[model samples]
Target: MKSGSGLKDRLVAQARAEGFVDCRICRPWDVPQVPARLEAFLRAGYHGQMEWMAERTHWRGDPAKLWPEARSVIMLAESYTPEGDPTGILAHPDRGAISVYARNKDYHDLVKKRLKRLARWLIAEAGGEVKVFVDTAPVPEKALGHAAGLGWQGKHTNLVSRDWGNWAFLGSVFSTLELPADDVEVDHCGSCRACLDACPTDAFPAPYQLDARRCISYLTIEHKGPVEEELRGKLGNRIYGCDDCLAACPWNKFAVAASDMRYAARDDLNAPVLAELAALDDAAFRAKFSGSPIKRIGRDRFVRNVLYAIGNSGLTTLVPVAQALTDDPDPTVADAARWAAEQLS
Candidate 1:
């Protein structure tokens, strides 16, 4: 414990070297002033089918509400910026455009592995117990990031890092350590309506609020049933998450170019042909997306996304691909296939 360097600075230097793009600290007592804003967002049903976001309002706004004994929050951001606009692949009607974030690997697993390593290092130095979380937990990571000066919450309601753009996935560790809190960031989204203007479904009801029910990412990946009919055609070649909002942000001009080789582009995922993807059976789907984040969404949902992409392909040639999936055992896939076939005809 006699390292002359202070603990927090030592930890920050260790984290940056461990492939984490940025790390900042916050006291556990300081959850953002997210109560009214979160309550309003929830009350308005902006979270859509993410029912859990509404179920745990207490902890979502205040870390103290989650674990009162926790003394510090170590917030981390990992950048997943792609080399180019992911939407460029959309013009190839025969291709499937997986969101840049999901193409290479499951971030939850990747981030958790690194966070645990960091936590272990913390324990070795400070002898404190710790718990870590990626997006799966109730921890308000975006709020913690804002408090720690990593970034501010942009109007799109995603944390915007000056160094990482909006392309970062957040993770946090709630620990018993009493690390000093870092500086906080202020919102700089002033007068920029780029995110609002770029949304295809007009999901933003106002500058800062999002209506997830109309969001393509929610509709394609999270929503279980048939996608809202009117919005299906707008989904385009996107078979997974939408990046329009993040890509349109002017602040991305200053975004860091990632050096993580693990996050580098994979040829198959960069722009997969829609016809080839739409025909995948369960076995083929598993093989193709083996290490990717999309695998967790499962074959049915993956095929459902493929059907949505096919419907938006504007090519009559893909009707056969839809016809092949119309009788899929998973009803969601079958339903989407029928919709796509009709759209093509």
Candidate 2:
């Protein structure tokens, strides 16, 4: 027999009590009619340099094969809504707009800690084992979240919760205990193409599908080398990730303030001076971004991005800064700086 308690309510209450902004439960199964949907997404090469996305097509969309023993999936969301609209920073060309996710220390560490504790509690109460996932997993977490009624997948393709807006970082807690599934929420994006029109690079070719090849987030944070020359200026001062699509959603009005303190904006990260970031040596870069997710990009690539921003800044004052990186050991950094110096000169 299943546990006497109503597992859904108990888990939801437990989630809130554990400081998760919201939680929802869903059955572990194949995404009905999503194989071709995914095949189309891959066929269009929407995943870009994220080769792993296409490599594990089988285990990604279905949770059952990921862990055959899993009976229920608990999808939890943590909000990182900013104190103010981040879009305002775009006008300040000299300042690089770091994506809100990297504004604080990494969420993967913070959310995983909370998820493990929550999973432990569930196992203790229900007398079973559990597994936890935070972003890096074979499971289609956003799809599972949608199935669990956590939110609908917006046109931007990121899960958008009615309560948290599009400012959520997702984590999953898979368990062996059987839990009643919640009603899956239907898409609320009906007739609203705000996100589709708002993207600077127009990353989305169609509704609910993202061609990550053109996504600024993928370009700055994921892609390596001399980011497409034509797309360089279009990147503006958004040195990290782009959020124009997420910010344009009308549903974001319902968002509450950030629930995780780590997700809160750091004064230093909110709008970093491109000139200052461009000057960071490896030691200085590590010292400054230690424990922050931005550190993962390293000084060379990070500086390369800053050089591109400085070029777009059109601020002649940053010319000397770009010229200084002219002879740097890293070819990418040097090329970016040279390009920026030429443009800014």
Candidate 3:
């Protein structure tokens, strides 16, 4: 079996050929800082309704504990940078703005497939046992990515690379082989607050800290039931997830084109009309987002978000549409619809 620099070099080459933008390695226990930061965030209730985060603290805080046999972590980045300005749809309030990442196929499936293939290649070439992850588990991907020298966690608390920018999906392979670890990436945000300043709901309490309760993405995607009336207006036309902070980042200027065409925006999803999105019934919503990440939120929550967007749109033409849903079977959807109708009135 190949070992040392030769094996690591070939593994990186194989990853690039598999469509990953960058690949690096780190020791499983490299991130000593995660436990405390995670504890603080959970204590402050910043994770909001994501109780899973608190539930999996032991594993999430340390990769070494998650898999004791794993000696090295192979972290990889796959670019999904949008073709045009993702924020452009915000100008058209009558339209719903879906996050760039959710514009097409589910990234979890795409990135995981690639990670598994890479893991297979690693085992074949180096005879190492491996396990791959792509956001499904309680993995601290960003921390591992930083430790692997993929990028620094930016002020927005997302991984940001000087080479690939902030528009990438992170995946990891945990291996029993002790490959050489890379130097950690240092923070380059240095006084740049573009991400923090651009948040419509001021989700960031400070640099590198996010308050998910006030975050549009969290409200639209994770939060169950009706969002607080005070924050609903701030949601604007973003019906699925928010990207204002990501779009405003200066590092994105270096973002490479997505290697997979599946990541490209679908015309129907790019800037869908708010009224059309609000009209999605369960079957229609499932069919529309069949293979997409947006399907997980389900129709009721999705339409609830649409109603909030309709309220913020200031488009009185949508009043009837909102009124129609005021009697929706889903109480949350009904609440949102009534709120939207009142806002339009």
Candidate 4:
């Protein structure tokens, strides 16, 4: 039961039935250009505190090296496009704006389960060993997505599709069966700097290049301890990951609705009041964000982000909320609270 005739077509049809918006395949070694680009990004210290990215260069730079026996990389996209404009919450400084992807359940869990099911199906049909990966692995999903023709990497360094837009989550199924590969997707981002210009923190050094240290998403989620004073003010009300680049893309006009209802924005997280979020103790925060991706940052980091939002709120009423957290046990949260209190004062 090797990859016989009509197997590729059937695999794609099964993927669609499993709820993936788009599916394409590429050979494991197709992305020959990744090593140099990855080296350049790491050499420039653009990865910031994400040292794991620098550690696994051999595996991360080439999918072939990850599993030498794997033949085809099945790249799939699942859309999580928000029903309403995600950036609209930015105007309301009193509210904390969470990234569209993090507004509901964690995508890693959701996408991984789908990928596992697809991998099982592929194994049964083709009699080949299979491994599934969502985001946690060192796999270069965006590059493979481009190689597989699901989409091209846009100027913001995220995968953008003409058919499905830029709001899709990428997952891969690595298989030993030699499946036919799809045509590569060429770049369509011509002379557009909307994503670069839209960054509140000026994170993008140039088109298609991102400096994670200056990115609000990294500052809030990945970077530990107090964020640089200069950058904290630019975070605005974004308490989690930032979506300025994704929301600014004109390609989203063609974006389709997310297949799973679980990806839809939860009512509480959509535009949570900053003052209320700032008041969350450890237990309260855990209870509020149960099963959410935001919970992984823990109560301290989350509160630190909330205090920054409160400081930026300028509502004067939230000054007390920031003031109360000034003595928080977590030094980072305390520092953020003090900084936020001073901002509102």
Candidate 5:
């Protein structure tokens, strides 16, 4: 088996060849602070409806506890920087704003395939047991990414890289082979509260902390029922996920477009008209969002979000679109339609 600095160098080279922008290694025990932070977040009910965070606290909080046999954690960064300003779409009330990340193909599918390829190469070259994970697992990927020197968890609580900024997807590879860990990154967000102040719904309670319940991303994607009445107005035209805080990061000036074309924004999804999106039936919704991450939210919940955007749009032309769904089979969708109609009326 190839072991040492030579093998580590080869691993990084292979990762780049596989299209990862950055790669680094860290031990499973590197993120000792995760457990306490997670405990605080869960205790404060900041996780919102994500009960999975509490279900596997032991594994989610500590990587060493997740798999003791794993000697090293390989963190890979895949950049997906949008070609244009992701926040600009919010100004066009007639258009619905999808988060930059969801404007293309699902990162989970793309990143997972890349991780598996790296895992296969590692097994062949380093001859060790390997397990690959994207976002599906309970792994503390952002914490591990910081520990691996890929980036630090910025004030936004998202992994922010000096080289890639905050517009990257993270994947982890656990291995039995021992590898040299990189130096941990320190926070560089000195006196910069841009991300905190940029939030439309005031999701951040303080630097390095976030309240998911108040986040537009959580409201549009994760929250099951209709969103809180007060918060719905703050959503604006952002129907899928919100990127205001991410776009506010100053470090993005140094960021580059994704090397993978799959991450590029789709033409249809780029500032899609709210009336057209709200009119999509279940079949059309699935067909339009096929192979996209937005499909996970399903049509009913998706239309519910569009209704919120329509209400906030003030585009009286969308009244009939909202009126048509006033009797939607889904109660949440029906309630959203009524609310949107009231706003437009």
Candidate 6:
């Protein structure tokens, strides 16, 4: 127990040195509420087309089930808070509003690199097997994060740190070492419904729950095929993940800007013209967003999102661009283009 106590502090120190904004530990079984909450989310079909969420339900809802050998779950956060208002570009309908996180390099690569560094150090220090994961895993990161005292899950269902707000990316390191666990963070959301009210698509069925099928981020980045026509106009100019709920958080007043310049929004991505993004072919899209998280969505889905933005822009001049894409090779992009051109007409 004495060695366990010492190792916990060392791990936290190492994580901070690796540029993690915050780090905390919890036992694998700390998140008891996850099973019921996740089951309810799945039963309600809130995961939308993310079928992977259902495939690993047992492991996702119970960290103990994920790897029985894991004794400690270390949850870390790295801030990506934008220097300016993330939602400011939404008003400029002619420009795309890529989520602040996606405007820079892909966080999976950046955060995983830091997590691996910490994991390697942990193995050397405590001689325990470790596995690191970013958002790619089915791990209930936010639930474990709340249990680890990093933050409480806010009304938006995203982890909200009193110190770092919701503008942070989460990563986890599962270790066989039995480290001392931190006290859990209780809900600090109180009466604030700012995040709930800020949803442009009404994605939240209630506070603390989200219907991803109706979410702009899911539509633009994850959902394939034609977007539900009714929701396209509400997408406004957001061409990637949406940040409305995170930007609406009142807790941001206490948030600090990210220390890593890798998260700084790129000038080109900050306010890319709708017509320009709408014109990117597969190769051009790849070249433009090679290292960006947005590249994962591919040109077809991305152009579909851009068409939605162009349709919502109310700029008749962009009608021709939308009309030109009406015959795009990708059926979804063509569907979106026809809808956009029709919206303008």
Q: Estimate each model's TM-score.
A: 0.94, 0.97, 0.99, 0.98, 0.98, 0.98
Over 4 Å off, model 5? none
lDDT of 6 by residue, 1-345 (tens): 124677878888989889988999998899899999988988999989989889878889898998999988999999988998989998898999999999889999999999999999988887879999999877999999999999999999999988988889999999888888899998999999999999999999999999999998898888989888889989999989899999999999988778799899888998999888988999999999999988888999899999999999899999999999988989988999999999988
Candidate 4 lDDT tens digits, 148-265 = 9999999999999999889999999999999989999999999998999999989988888989999999999999888898898899999999999999999999999999999998
Residue range 132-158, candidate 2, lDDT tens digits: 999888778888889989998999998
In order, candidate lDDTs are 0.85, 0.86, 0.93, 0.92, 0.93, 0.91
- Compute the lDDT of residue 25 as modeled in candidate 6: 90
TM-score of 4: 0.98
lDDT preference between candidates 2 and 3, better one: 3
> What local lDDT score does residue 250 receive in model 1, on the 0 to 100 scale?
85
Q: Which residue segments of model 4 deviate by more than 4 Å?
A: none
Better of 2 and 4 by lDDT: 4
Model 2 CA deviation exceeding 4 Å by range: none
Candidate ranking under lDDT, highest first, comes to 3, 5, 4, 6, 2, 1
lDDT of model 5, residue 11: 94
RMSD list, candidates in order: 2.1, 1.3, 1.0, 1.0, 1.0, 1.1
TM-score of 3: 0.99
Q: What lDDT does model 5 reach?
A: 0.93
Question: How well does candidate 5 match the true structure in TM-score terms?
Answer: 0.98
Clashing pairs in 6: none
Measured with C-alpha atoms, the lDDT of residue 245 in candidate 1 is: 91
> What ranking emerges by TM-score with the best candidate at the front?
3, 5, 4, 6, 2, 1
lDDT of 1: 0.85
